[model samples]
Target: MPFVIAVLLAADAVSLMAAGDRAFAARDFRAALFAYQDLTREDPGSASVWVRLGETYARMGHDLEAGESFSRALRLNGKNASAKEGLAASRERLAILSPPPKPVVDEAGARERYTAAVRMINERNYRDALNALDEALRKRPGYAVALVARGSARMGLLDYDAAAADYSAARGSDPSLASPLFGLAEAYRALGQPAKAAQLYRAYAESPATDVQPALKEYALRNAQSLGSQ
Candidate 1:
């Protein structure tokens, strides 16, 4: 009975290998991949089975998976020439798939977009201001002034959530900047977060930035006091 069971298992393995080979030869790589995957699960110790799975993955343009499968085969049998070749081929293909990093935008280009956004904001054209700010931010991801401006534009458009996000980001990028704190306070107030709004308003009023005019500080303090009363 034991001998019979062993023979049956061996025959099943052979059948799966043959099925995979036939599918591979017919250019049905998906079917080949499934068959080989099953064979690998059944006989994980077999380097040849892993090699077949790796080959199917390569044919299907799954270079990363192919490389992993080939690496597994190499671990099982360090003498696996097919696994070595497949790993190298996968690496070559992967390198081709990955493009070079984008070149950094020049400072002047980012400033140009930012200047346009400021002009549009002054004209009360919040929609066009947002478009310009998007380009500016893409060119310079951590532009604190631009983020503050974008927050104001979002406010004008009644996009309170986005305004809050931009204000928060601006504050994070330049903690000492009173403009972002004021913007963030207003955004929080609009978002119904009164406690946060009050805290930020007080902070903006107390900020030591010389550009924060006396009238603006007085207004911020008034808002903070009003929210505190609530």
Candidate 2:
């Protein structure tokens, strides 16, 4: 009777482990997690079980739990690659979840505010231009046009570092935005990154255009001159 009971328990553990493997293979992370959780409970000494559980958690975006499970797996089987990979991924996910210190705001309303700021900058209203750009960014997060305008405004104000940051953000939001790329090139040049500026300028020159050939030619010539100076 005792032997039969032991065999039944073993069968149950094997069934759970097989189910977990199937779920993992299917990329059904939630189902895998449940199955692995059951297996881990049934066979606490199984390091592979813990590794699978950790992998499932990581796939499901439960970084903290994944980390803990991976750690436990490593404790039992130090050479486990899956556990090590899960631990690394979990740490990376946790790092991403960590909030940065600075506040970033850029949105749709930023377009109007940035346009106004550009007008103010043209009129030599430096301080007002800065304030308007700031307000625009505060209202619209990740507004590429506003970022480019703010960078341009900052450049006029001689705030080179801030201008570079704004230009970088603008370029990041839309890599194909020609104006922002131009602004980045100019910003980099101003900041003494002449090589970087020339590279960006070259990119701008090589980019395809939908506009008139005359404008494209002029833009290409300007970038060529800038690159030559570098």
User: Judged by TM-score, which candidate is best?
Assistant: 1
lDDT of 1 by residue, 1-230 (tens): 59999798889889999999999999999999999998997788999999999999999999999999999999999999999999999999999889977768667777999999999999999999999999898888888889999999999999999998998898899877889889989999998999999999999899898658798899999999999889
Candidate 2 whole-model C-alpha lDDT, 0 to 1: 0.82
Off by over 4 Å in 2: 1-109, 209-226
Q: Measured by TM-score, how close is model 2 to the native structure? A: 0.49
225 in model 1: Cα distance from truth in Å? Answer: 1.1
lDDT of each: 0.92, 0.82
Number of clashes recorded per candidate: 0, 5
Please give the lDDT score at residue 199 for candidate 1: 97
**Residue 64's C-alpha lDDT in candidate 1?**
99
TM-score of each prediction: 0.58, 0.49
